[model samples]
Target: MDWQEISGNWVLIPPRPSAIVHFLGGAFVATAPQLTYRWLLEELAGQGYAVVATPFVNTLDHVAIARDVLNKFENALDRLYATKTLRKAYFPIYGIGHSMGCKLHLLIGSLFDVERAGNILISFNNYAARDAIPIVEQISPVFNVEFTPSPQETNRLVQEHYQIRRNLLVKFADDNIDQSILLAKLLQPRFPGMVAIQTMAGNHQTPLGQDVSWPVGQVFTPLDAIGQWVKQQVYRELNQLKREILRWLNPLS
Candidate 1:
């Protein structure tokens, strides 16, 4: 699947879409959204989902970043409508987020009136700067800088403000940083619609790339089953992830 950007938006437009998905990546780098979420985005695109992936610089000020996501979504929609690529842009809009991306989507759902159809949160976490990066703990005193929406602040905001209807929280088996439990705990009280938590067979980085080192631009031996086995193993986690997302998004279908 090939997609070009319009007005600083990377849009993966499918021929016909079951839904429109806005993809948000994790923290640390302000790199290209397609670069980090390529595997997941491609899979979702193949499954008839139009995905708009946006990049952002990770910062302590998460509230501002959340607002930026909303702005990016609007800009992408503007471009799609102007180009006439979206014949009918009335499909339900969904937000899919990983790590810090999950926090941003949750913030948007809570604070903004975006009318999101659903939200898929994977491995959500809101760590203080000191805990998020152990090294930062050592130097925090020198800069007197603190991470905005620290763990405590994140919990408080979501507990009081989150208002999304349909949500699917995913947790991996071996991920210590799987903070879905905490997020589910906070949402159970306020969320009126379906709030489901699912555990899959992978780690925090499972949905990001589907594999740790291989299957990414690897030169394989020119054999059929050998290559196919490796390919399946490489993307097992993400394959399952995509399937789960489709099931949740269109349960009746």
Candidate 2:
């Protein structure tokens, strides 16, 4: 997957205070299908954020495949930062992901030295599918990164921080709801303050595409509604990110 700027019907927000916000999309869908995501990117740009959404092939399932894709993303970020096409310096960098995209973010965030990254935002992270052993095994060789339990590692390595935010957002009405909760609990000990899971109504794939309006007492939720909700969340997060960038640029004020 080549890292490219998001194009087509999307608005661009100039970088504020030298910060860049990149949105990563999930599996089995092209980046274009994520209309709500597009809106979010535009909103972020409107708020003085230089937003870029990178497209990747969603064919791979294994953590190793995902990591390879993430490497491309990391390299693209480096190129973008080096060109300094968006803004000045001392700006914050952030990665935003949804669904499988969230998993990819976790893998990259944990393995890569994204310390310069201001923060990571993840939505609907279903950790049940990810094989921890394979993920750790694949990632360990890349960085010579062994799992040595330390204070900082304990905090940021797992999705602990994410859990705090999750308790507020979660609305469990489905069977797989436990998957999200369990993943957060499992990661708490290792990455005490890393993962943040925000809950929205619907199953794993509900928020990906368009939202639908179902009749009352219907068996399933409307896809259109879920899609709209996802889009709304994306817009809100991007807008906040833009504000953060603007603040970073004018720190003294």
Candidate 3:
């Protein structure tokens, strides 16, 4: 399906959508999520979901970023409803995020009064500004800066606030930078049996990538064969992630 821009968000709406998925991508590729996360988002759309992917430029103040994206997402929903693109009847809404996007979703869920059926956090990473953006330390040694809520403060907020009952934390097998386990510990207590953790294959960058067309040469070469194999692996990983998310999204029925 072709994506449309509404309220500064890229949206892919199917003819009949069972639910809506509000997606936020990782910091580096978030600016153009429609292109960077096209494969994953479109897969969700293909599975009867109206995908609303919001793009945001990353800054040190993650709280502000979260608030802004939430506002934009809500506004887009409003427009969709007003235009009759989305039915006025009750429909489930879920939040899905990758990498830094996961932290934004967490902050939004904790700080706002928005209603979400559940949240799917993939490769969650909450790093200090110095570590997330190494150039910040190299450029200025005099000032000490960090994310607005800070890593520790974010955890405190989640522990004290996060109201969402259903949460799915997805951690990749080879992702060294992932911190979903720590997040699960913080959230599991607040929600008890509602929190679930699922381990998947692939690394931090698994959620980012689009299909590339590998042109055939006059004669089939090993390099060409290797390219085809790599493409298959990428699609395999992406499809696996999609299946896991769809399974959690429809656990009961």
lDDT of 1 by residue, 66-112 (tens): 88878978888887888888874488999999988999998888788
Best by lDDT: 3
lDDT of each: 0.82, 0.47, 0.92
What's the distance in Å from true for residue 10, model 3? 0.3
Q: Candidate 3: how many backbone clashes?
A: 0
| Candidate number with the higher TM-score (2 or 3) | 3
> Which stretches of model 2 miss by more than 4 angstroms?
1-18, 30-36, 81-83, 116-178, 191-197, 200-253
Instruction: Tell me the TM-score of each prediction against the true structure.
Output: 0.90, 0.52, 0.93
Give the alpha carbon lDDT tens digit for every residue of 79-155 in model 2: 65577644335656565555555555555655654543533433434432223235656665566443222223433
Q: Among all windows of ten consecutive residues in candidate 1, which has the lowest summed lDDT?
A: 210-219
The TM-score between candidate 1 and the true structure equals 0.90
Q: How would the candidate models be sorted by lDDT, starting from the highest?
A: 3, 1, 2
